[model samples]
Target: MIAIVARSENGVIGKDGGLPWRCKGDLQFFKRTTMGRKIVVGRTTFEGLPPLKGREIFVLTRKPDAGFEGATAVSNPADVPADAIVCGGAAIYDLMIPQCDQLLVTTVKKEVEGDTFFNFQWLEGFEPEETIEETDEYSVVSYRRSGPSS
Candidate 1:
């Protein structure tokens, strides 16, 4: 599985249930990368999203019976497919990061206040495979797991 996220310099990924920064390039990059793929997200993240067209969405929630429209509800991380792209709201990332073989991260150039943060230490076992300076406001980095997979 691959984990994808956009975070500020201080690791802030969200503020008041949404992104802390407004970077159009990062938004475009996310859409281009995840389009037509299966995406796994936490319930809160799923709820905040606008209509996502052309992608299969799996919402990880304790209440799998809650019946989220237009998305499949999954209770366990094991229920998520190996090829699914894991998106976040922190907790989902924490749960799925261990299963991720790669990480696609967009780092917004500045730090901003947020209630949720991503731990960069999670990337410790991964190595940067590629990095693209998308714009002055942000850059995208791809990290692949180093060494052999267990």
Candidate 2:
């Protein structure tokens, strides 16, 4: 039940520790999907997050104990919670994407100036199962990991 959640323009997700644009819709979507989920991310992404009160977080870093309250670091992605939400600073998502079961992406309509981008491709068996249309700014797409072929 793993999921990758992100918002981007032309596959680029961030710049200067902030999202390149403002889209309230996409922000809410990101919140809705991730709240209460077990979230796994890197140090930078964790620092970028707004205060999360009760959510469980696992951060990937060389410093296993280098994060705020309610977060612990495990060296690799395999040890994360089953229905983990991989939120990111790009590198975390890249390392964990292959084992991810679902992806929730918000594709911004405009190209952004950024230092990070999502480099993972939607695998062969994944289905573009859900899409939230052509908006004034971006589109929200959910890619689900489909089961074995018929």
For model 1, the superposed segments whose C-alpha errors exceed 4 Å read 148-150
Candidate 1 per-residue C-alpha lDDT over 1-150 given as tens digits, one digit per residue, 9 for 90 to 100: 889999999989998778878898998888988899999988889887888998999999999898989899999888998889999979998888878889899999998999999887778789999996567899999999896433
* Model 2: ten consecutive residues of lowest lDDT: 1-10
Q: Which structure among the candidates has the greatest TM-score? A: 1
Residue 88 CA displacement from its true place in model 1, Å? 0.7
lDDT of 1 at 98: 77
Residue 2, model 1: lDDT of 89
| Deviation (Å) of 86 in candidate 2 | 0.8
Tens-digit lDDT track of model 2 for 43-102: 887887777766788888877756566788887666887777878767776677667777
Best by lDDT: 1
